[model samples]
Target: MAKSFQNFSILTSIVTLSVLMFSQGMLDTAHAEEYDFVAGIHNEVTFHFRNGIETVNFPVFSTTSDIVSNIGSSFEVEGVVGNNPYLHKALDEAYLYRMSTLSGGNSFEYNYRYFDVDVNIVQNENVLKSFKYDNCEISGYSVSTLTDDYESYLASDTGFAIVNNIQFRCGGVGINLDSDKSSLNSESRSFTDYGPLPFKLAEDVRTFLTFEFDHGSEKIESVIFTLTSGFSEANDAGPSFQIITAVLPHPLIDNAIDKSQKVSGMASTFNEDFDVSVEFTNSQETLRGLDFQDCIVSGYDILTLRDKEEGYTGKRGFATAEILDVTCSGLAPVNPAFDKLSDAKESRSSQMSNTYTTNSYNMGTGPHVIATFDFDSGTEVVDFPEFYQGNMIARANPTFTLVGVPGSTPLLYHVVDNTQGSGPKSTGVSSNVELFDVNLVLAYGNDVVRGFDYTKCRVVDYIVRTEHDADESFYKGFALTDEFYFECQGYEPFNPKYDELFETSHAKTESSSSWKEKQRDAWGPGFR
Candidate 1:
């Protein structure tokens, strides 16, 4: 069997304004506004080799040239148009232009120009070799124009790809001879010259092959896998079997497939004895799911959980010490004065008298006269006595005198009931009769004469009289005719007594005799 030969290669290059800094006579441009760069593979190809024959699976030289042109135009338009204005300005000012190309065989180059200055970047190739069975190969590559554009290109196309070839050669196929004196020419009868022949030798085998470039072109910024080979049965069964799972960090394979049979329900089942089950409780401690035990009640007081006394079910929980009944003494007795007046006791005589009277008398006929007199009744002299008693006898139309009568004299008097017909009543006059019933003698002599007609009396001695009586008598002698008359005499002197006395006695009197002297001592004068 013929050997299978598969080759793959990848390349990448990145350029930036920093590269222009190293060029001679390439002064950094400060404010160039716009710039352009190109990034595309110049030639990329993939071939399948069988028996030393190569068939182009993906040919970039002729068929894929449009793809390269489109890529280059895309980079020039997108990278330049979207770049920072200052960076574009610097590039344009420096006349900076860059180009990058990548081929299928991990071949790449970066060419930069700033005016007359030029720079080249390259990445060396990474190759894999095998000699056991037919060799199979695959490769990936990429190329970047500007540093910024490189990132964009990788993000878009990721990386490059190279096709693989499958081929076989029969073992033990040596020189052969034909019959009938015809000889088979070894050179003339090539491998294809005869019909299909089969031969076998070693065990079935497989391997991975890749070609990568590291041409020292601004370093290999990153290597990414854009394509990968398919999986095989051997990969599923191998101890370290790997399948292409992810791409960014080169490639990845998970152990899930390699260890699938070791899972539950499979022949090489996973260990069920090692499995554990857990349960969560409302307590601080944990217990195994299969175990049962009483939990320790944290933060619970045992004393609070038990009754205070045995069989004491009054309160289910705890209680403090019982408080004995308390009694207090030493309170002072309240005064009866402060107590509310009861209905029975409240009827007692009032402490403050309500009726008020003055000593002055009225002279006008129909006017009221409050006559006041002092009396010597053999006990103490009553200054302003509350009651007076007397019996009065009529001496019709009698006249009396008022002068020089001492106020101490007593006389018999009566309150005549003027409301009756013509004469005194049989029941006699009561002491409580009105004062007008007693005809007050304006003045009186020594005569004991009395009656409502005392308006006539004149006597040898002056006299004044008021009514008085004994406790049981209907009428009694009150004071001497002297006392009442004396009061009357005093009042008659000042007929309009109230006003005249008040002015004379209450006025601010002056010691001076003459009218001039009195006027001189008036309020505004020097005497003031």
Candidate 2:
């Protein structure tokens, strides 16, 4: 954007006189009061502009052209009409009169001239872009013809007008609205001075105007503006101070999309009570949908944009990275560098691969894997495992030894019910009761576990006990029994030593001398 902002300086040569000061050669023409430049134009619609202590009047003779240049930069001033440059020059003959301060110190610069059917004004920090009177049916009036048809312009006057696009900047931190986009605010000064605004000096005031936001910042906790007009340090009877404050409701979070800060109350300075919320998302899909090239790095307000995506106005998002760690007692080889989990057919892959690609999965059985996550910043690497739901590979068909303790309940398989064991038809007793610990070393289906959370579905051991019993013969009162060595088909005896026998009662004669020798046969040397 070009530098379009500059203050207009007034020329020192223009002077207002109480008595007529015209040339003696022209003294015979007409009224000397016409030469008073500060006198407002009354023929058409009365109008006057202020520059601190001075007020500018409409030209009386319609012959001068240097007045507007003395006041400010030239932009086809409203009082003068037509695209033709010279026809407009004739309207400059009007003069301006110096007026007293109707209010505060000369703190504001006010200037105006008809420009494109509207008045253009420079009011202090704000620029009055346009001010138009629609109710006044005046037309066909030019600088050269205004004096002649000044009465014609006023003849069709109504009582309404509108001021459009008064542009101004409120720059700096704590100076911007929440979820905001623009630094420029547009205010309107309408037909309040009994005319189309700024008709005279005393009526100029910026009241109850919202001071909700400042410029150059979005994370402002709160902003406040005090509108104190009548009470400048020089005037006690000036305006009372009215305060307006806007506070942010919540702190801005990282990668959260469509966020906004609500006004603390119902009234605020914003055109709308709430601004466009911070348009951002942490979702990768959402980011890709937008001009993804402009994704913001990590934690920033919604207004922050990437250099490459300067023109992108859509919401933003963040990137993601994660890792899984597996610590197993019976694993093949620790390969943190292995990419495909399929490689860990009998071992774990080094490179963090998808857990789904592992050889086979197991829950609480041998070799379980754990996983760790690196969310937005991807700065974390894991040592031990935690959140993974698969199995590991080790010895497959594990061997179990058979040894029966004299008293302790054994992990029985194919346990025969009392009623079934008592029948004469029963051959060998081995049927219902059971307890088997299903421990196995399995491998991964993949390196990484899929889905939102770890889908841990592994086949471990289920020790079957009497958690539910509807019959008494199921676990009680066995009749006929014999010594039976129960063991898995291909397994060897564990040869576990025992200290005592369970329910065998002996006579005093056998207990007296050779009790140790007789019992030694059943439990060997453990009878003592």
Candidate 3:
């Protein structure tokens, strides 16, 4: 049976066709010349919308000179029009959005749709190559309209359509058309696979159309859009669809005023990882880090809606960052963390083996204790500054009496003793206005354990007490001693330039050796 068609007529006012033709020839075109431009005649196109609705329509294409040869009839398939229709409307909308960039609108809105188109290359009666552009969209487009009057005989509206990402598959069967084929074989065999996936036809596949109208009826007489193949290669394959699963870490998105997200104002194809950084409005840092582990970023902006009572607020501003493909792993808590208070108690108990109470006297073997502070006038103190353990006596419960020396015109008037009670919160003490250094000293048989030379110091806390108040039996019959506790600082370590005041004292008396021997005997053989 011989199938034939001639002088096909396109009925609809608007139509879209995707063509990715090759110049080098598909299989073997050594003996074949250039393929003449031919028309693709599909009975209908089915459009799939965002709301899941489907519509089948016959999109018009001028075909007065589109004559199908008997030999080329073998390329025709026996089926309904392809399920995916060329996205003509989507492409037009995308192009208009691109044009809007000139006026600072900076917004594009569209729902992605799928469509299929075919490209045929013919030389006289023989069709050299045929391909199907499946799941393709107009990634790019431009228009130029011309009206010419030559002797007032005829007028025309002509335009050229530059399309991209039109996948071309040979024999019209599967995706990844050139994957199994070699580079040389793929290049010479596939139509547009040589570029990027969703291969685009750059040079020879552009469509040119002209509108013809009848002046008497003021109506369009015919529409002609041609797909020309300059060469025929039998191995030439067509376009295909790639199934991509959304990966993470994904892109950074902004919460619009309406809380919608966006990627681009027009069509976008991300072949490589996009690296972008953004800072929030009124943020201190130039770029803030984001954690988008698993997100399917909405690639387009969500347009505002309107009702009679509530009007649309329009699109809000937003920032965009690239979607990254990465893996995510869980982290465990930190092990063997340190606690300062607990560690201090343990250390003191382990080394000293004894504790002291407030105002109690103990004469035994212990870590050497002596310290000194020098401060300049005008220094203010609020709370006790933690002293370095090596520079101070690290005892379980220890206190030192603070004595005020006269020449400096004392900022403090009492002698403070070590105690375990919560001391009075002293209004900060400020040193005398005159710049002079006041010396503080702790003596142990004329030897100092360590000296801390502070540039300034003050009494941050002061507590006064009578001996009877602390230990009732110790002080009887109105003969009682008063004790004070003071905490202070507003000072920093001063320069110890050849200063002997900072040297630790290691002087020992006869009593010290006796105490050491007693400690060793008390601990039995376990003492080291």
Candidate 4:
């Protein structure tokens, strides 16, 4: 963007006249008969900061260009029309108005031409209402022209009037609608006078009170006007001071594929109220058919893009929401393996000497084997061991003793020469053992296919063993086995059907324990 001080000559002329009038005591006093409050047609807007001031104005003959001041707010003025360049500048220019004070002290090199100014509404040569707009910026700017209209343009009113048409994002608006002259806030308040003056304009005051707010289709409640006018400080009526306000556009969601998911009532800033899930729901609509029923909002990003395109005059800046992922959901599948499994599988293949290919897949293979066993002990567990099947059994005692061989050669034996039996063996009655519920689950891969519930089982003894034999039919010679000797507390032991343990108390106990362990492992050891 180029800076054009094209109005320097005009400003010098105005200052020269101002100094002359001051010397003649014409600018010293308020409420004087010679004082004039009418505004000039060729007006200039000046931005006064703590360090210095920068001023801008339209060409003397240009009528197509205009300045819009939102009192207690900002100024959006079209820049000088030219083929050279435009003020489609950076967001830093417009965002400077975000400050509490209207002045941004020389921090930027390019003046996007935004500032606060006071406006005096004058009627019948008398001031009626006063308004003030604070920190401001050129919110928008555009340049456009068509060839067919050149004939009409040549016949029209002016030339070089198509340049600096820029909108503004401004800060607070303060107004003094004081009709009574009893207070200092009367319309006659000091204003920084600019341009050649009959001291005023012949146009109706309402004609100068135009402001286009960026809110979507909402009704406007107030009218703020900004200008380079105020009571003269030399007149003992120093430039009138008024409060200002920032009017930001309503937050919007654009370019969304799913319009139904775009919800309203999201806050634009942290100061506003917001719901995390609601925002997430709306943000997810940026892409179609993308829904996360079990997702959470980890953080948010707000992008404020400045409007720099021609023929686009709605909002000066737009805010877009960006989503971030966070693992805050506490839902787990029915089986632990299910959490570790993926929908797709990875595989590799190998070819043997016979040209038979073997493909190994990453997916879990289904359970292919089930084993059954039976055992008996004398004490209520079972009737007896399988005596008829040639199984070796160890009795309570044996008289003959044998010693092992040394270096795989020979064995030694000690023979009992005498035996004594005093009397008949005494028999004792067996007592019943208490039974508690137990559940046994059968699974294939990550899926639980069946479960068994023993409602009245007192486990006497259980053994788990792996045996190996060279003559086994299977590829691997090793076999895993589990044996359980359980006694029923009731009169008769009935086998419960499979899948009957789905809602059993024992199942629930195990599930709860597993859940607790999973939570601790996921978060921390302190988690319960």
Clashes of each: 54, 52, 26, 34
- Please write out the lDDT profile of model 3 over residues 330-418, one tens digit for every residue: 11111111122235547666321111111222324432322332322122121111122222344322223332111111122211111
lDDT of each: 0.19, 0.20, 0.23, 0.26
Best by TM-score: 4
Selected candidate, larger TM-score, 2 vs 3: 3
Instruction: Kindly list the per-residue Cα lDDT of model 2 for residues 1-528, writing each as its tens digit.
Output: 133322211122222231122211112222222321111111111222221111121111110111111121111212222122222221231112113212322442223322222222222323212222221111123323222134333533311111111111111101122322222322432111111111111111111111122221122111111212221222223122221111112112111111111221225322221111111112121110000111111111111111111111111111010010111111011112222223453364233222221223234544333222222211112221123222223233222211111111111111212211222222332233222221112223332222222121111111111111111111221111111121121211111122133446765554534766666566845554
| Candidate 3, run of 10 with poorest lDDT | 215-224
Over 4 Å off, model 1 = 1-366, 378-494, 497-528
Indicate the residue-level lDDT of 52 in model 4: 33
Model 1, 4-59: lDDT tens digits are 22221111112344333322113322111111101111111111222112111111
* Cα shift from native, residue 498, model 1 (Å): 11
Ranking by lDDT: 4, 3, 2, 1
- Lowest-scoring 10 consecutive residues by lDDT in candidate 2? 317-326
Cα displacement (angstroms), candidate 1, residue 67, comes to 99
List TM-scores for all candidates, in order.
Answer: 0.10, 0.13, 0.15, 0.21
Cα lDDT for residue 235, candidate 4: 25
Q: Output candidate 3 Cα RMSD.
A: 34.0
